[model samples]
Target: MLYQLNQLRDLSSLFTRKEVKRWLKDDFKSIDIKLERYNLHKKNKGSNYLKFLKETYKILEENYPNEYILKNEFLNKWLKSELGNQNSLIINEFRTGKAIADLAMFNGVSKAFEIKTILDKEYRLSNQISEYKKIFNELYIIIPKIQINKYINYDDCIGIITYDSEVKNFELIKKAVKNEEIDSNTLIEILHTKEYLEIVYKYYGHLPEMSVFTQYEVCKNLLSKIPNQELNSLFLQIIKKRKVNNLFFNKVNNEFNQICLSLNLKDSEKNELIKKLKTNIN
Candidate 1:
C-alpha cells in the first residue's frame, strides 16, 4: 500500500489535526502515507483519489484474505470513490422496525444494497427482499462471484452487483429492474421525525391534536394518507434538502468512513469509535 501524501488536505476539514495524525498513523501504517504532512502547510500536490485507492485496494485484497474483504475494499470505500461522492447520503446497517438493510442510499430515488459475502448464505434472502421492496424504489443484492449464478436463479428483478477478488473490483453483472410498486409507507419510514412533520404540516395542517408521545404515529398516519405521487415528491424533496444539510450528520458518517478506511473495524471498536468521533468533533 502506498499514498501520495496529500490525501487528507480535503478530508482534514472533517477532522482535527490530532485525530488526523492518529488516523493516518493507524490506517496507513503499512503504506507510505504522506497525506497529513503534505497537506499540513496548506499545499496540495493534488492526488488522484481513485488511482491511489485502486492501488491500495489491490494490495489489501491480494494480501488479506477475509470473507468480509469485499465489504471494506469494494462495497464501502471503493464504491463511494467510484461514485464521485456527489453529495449523496449513504447509510449502512439501515433499519426500519424489525428488518435491517445492509446499505441504503438516498439520491434521486432511494436505493438499497444487500451484501452477501463469499462466505454468506442466501437462505434468508426472501424475507429481506420482501421487506426491502416495501421501502426501496431500487434494490440490489451484492454477492461474490461464486454466488452470482445461485442468486441469478432466485430472481431477475433485483439488480446484481458482483465482486471478483481476482481483479479486486466490482462488476455490474445485471441491471436491476425498476420497481413499479413503490410503497408510500416505506417513503414515510425513511424520513426523519422533523422531515415527516414538516411535510405533513406543509401539506395538511397543524398536528391532529394528538399527544406528543404519539406524534410519530400521527405523522406516519398522516403521511400514509397522502396520495402516492405527492408523497413520493415530498420524499425526494426532503432527501435532496437533507443532502445539502448534511452538516448535522457529518461527524458520524465520517467516523464510519474512517472505520472502513482504517481497516480495523472490530465489533467492539465500532461503538467506542463512533462515540469518540462524535465527542471530539462536537
Candidate 2:
C-alpha cells in the first residue's frame, strides 16, 4: 500500500489536461490498477472522482513527505489568506539567473520561495538563495517542521516558513527583510522580451530603435541605465499585469490552486475541470 501511494506521491497527473480529459471520459483503467493494488477500490466505493482524489491526497499527506503538498499549503496560507483580494500573481518554478524559484509571488513587490522537503538535500540551497536574492524583494525558504534546526543559523534577511503537518498550517518562523539591493541586470534577464521592451518604453518614453537581432542587447543596455529601485518597481508592475481571471480563484478548490493557476488553462478548460470535479466514479 505504501509503495502504491508513493507512486502517486507527485500528484502531478491529477493536474494535467490530458489526464483530466481521460478521467472525465470515464477512463479509469490506469487509476483502477493503482487503487486496486493499494486496496482502496472498496474503501473508496461510490465517491466521486474528486472526493477520491481528495481522500488520496489526505492519505498521502499523512503518509509521505512531498513538495507538491508544501506548494499547495503555501498557496492556501499565503496566496489565499494574505493576498486573496490583492492584485498578485503567483508563479511556479519561476526562472531567474542560474536558479529557478519554487514559487514567486508578485504584487507591488516581488517575493520568492524555495521549498525544501525533508526528502530533499540542501546541496544547492545556497546557490538557489543567492540567485533569488538578486531578483526578489523578499526571500523565503519553506521547509518541514522537523528540518527547522538546519536553517536556524541562516541569514535573518531571508524568512523561514515552516509547515507543521500536525496542524496542516504554515507558520512564519522568521520575518524576511525587504531586499534593497536588487540586481538590475539579473532582474531584466528574467523578463520576457516584450515586458522589458515595455519597461524601456515606459521609462525612456520610446522603444529602442534596433534590429530584431540587436534589440535584446540594445534594450538591456537602455534598461540598465535606469535607477535600480525604479527598474525593480517597473518589473513588478509588468508581471502583475499578466493576470489570471478571478474565475479560477473562485471556482477551483484551494488544494489545486497552485497547479491550476500556473497551468494557464483556457477558460473552456477551466470550465471543464470545474464540471469534472463533481463527476462520479464507481
For 35-58, candidate 2 gives per-residue lDDT tens digits of: 676677887777766777776667
Put down candidate 1 lDDT per residue, 155-233, tens digits, no spaces.
7679888877776578878777766455666656767878888888877867678776998888878887887667666
Question: Could you tell me how far off, in angstroms, the CA of residue 53 lies in candidate 1 after the best superposition?
Answer: 15
Quote each prediction's TM-score.
0.61, 0.87
lDDT, model 1, position 263: 37
In candidate 1 the C-alpha lDDT for residue 250 amounts to: 30
RMSD of 1: 10.8
Worst 10 residues of 2 by lDDT: 243-252
CA lDDT of each candidate? Answer: 0.58, 0.75
